[model samples]
Target: MKKRTMRWASAGLVLSLFLASLSFVPSGSGNASAATSKSMAALYAQIQNERAAKVVALVNKERAAAGLKPLTVHTNLSKMAKDKAIDMFKNKYFSHTSPLYGSPFDMMDAYNITYRYAGENIAKGQKSAEEVVEDWMNSPGHKANMMNANYNLIGVGYYNGYWVQEFIGK
Candidate 1:
């Protein structure tokens, strides 16, 4: 009889533990999912921002080697570049001229970025900041934009697999 009672008690304890585990399990409801999504988006944006900053530093190092002044990051231009990067990623297009924003100049104008000279470089599918910068350095046109002594301001944006670098002189 004592063994029988012990077996029943153990079964009850196991059942209680199972029930308690269910309460700890995620419900996968709309609210919890939405919160998770929001946090993930914010974290992704932060990572992209860090990548963009690295691009700026690498570009500056190249400019320094070329005896050119380091370009300062402009907040307005950064915002514009980020918008362009996101737009290209979402719209599945890649170019200096965007379907939504026409040209880089048009994007700057839309963003109210004043500049005497402006240039933009866009790339897709490059894995890291160094790889993208190296690719741009190897290209004649992109190298021109990066090496141009006239440009004193820069904005870099990276999102998913897209990158945009905006150069401005004022």
Candidate 2:
């Protein structure tokens, strides 16, 4: 097991270096920026409006389940969330070993997922964001990792069809 892990570690290091090099290469910067903006615009709008409430609720719910006190939008947690994300990015496993480095945008995705679900629950008259998070933690697809030292729970989003994808890409 030790030998296997070492081999995987070396491979991951090589891959990360390769990807980092690729990301630094100059290749029509404007196109990439435009494409990213176009792809992310809808998601941005969704999160700001509809999904924001749900995500806040989900995080609050998870906090409650972990025996931590619940937080709110106006809570100190809103600012602390970004701090936690930076800490996650600095973890040795991510900074040294994993080829897939965590990014703020990725953290935002998790936030949006939680917020969207929480908002939906509110609309359905499910008052407890903590309950929503607890149910999600018990869900089949939730994955736990040591990387989540600060931000414990992150949501997984599913796509039902290609319509949204096509719309976003176009």
Candidate 3:
């Protein structure tokens, strides 16, 4: 009970911090409510532009020395991002009869997570799985997760367009 309570408290604190760090546009300010169509890469570029200026500078500095192209990366968004994503898969997504037992998730080292799924079912009235992932990746929880993992890269790999879902950490 004590352990569980502590975990809950920590989660709450981290979640609070994550929310506090979020930058929001005021209501009806700068097309905040309007739906502007943008491709995934465009949206990602925008997020990188706004959220990762420091990363951009560092990457440029290093790449200039190495004569390599600069890179933009995504880090975890919140403290609970990975945990919540894993739990969502274990409790809500994966099939109960899966051979992997309780969760088809593997923490592939301190920073990476991989999941093998026969299939996944999103909760009733919830967004599709892709949307869920996108939201989670962009949430405050992702940063928390990244910090905990001591990772600097945010990447997702789908093998053969099925079976394997690998979350990358660098």
Q: Which whole-number lDDT from 0 to 100 does residue 80 have in model 2?
A: 28
Worst 10 residues of 3 by lDDT: 157-166
Tens digit of per-residue lDDT, candidate 2, span 42-145: 78545433333564555555556666544434322233243332343444222211234244334334444332221111111223433434454564432121
TM-score of 2: 0.25
- Deviation in angstroms for 54 in model 2? 2.4
| lDDT, each prediction | 0.92, 0.37, 0.37
lDDT of 3 by residue, 1-170 (tens): 99999999999999998876654556765643243434555685554333334333433454446554443343432222233334445565433233333332323323343323211211222223343334433555432332323333333221111112222333
Higher-TM-score candidate among 2 and 3? 2
Misplaced by over 4 Å in model 3 are: 1-92, 95-134, 146-149, 153-155, 158-170
Q: For residue 25, what is the lDDT in candidate 2?
A: 32
Residue 170 of model 3, lDDT score: 39
Ranked candidates, highest TM-score first = 1, 2, 3
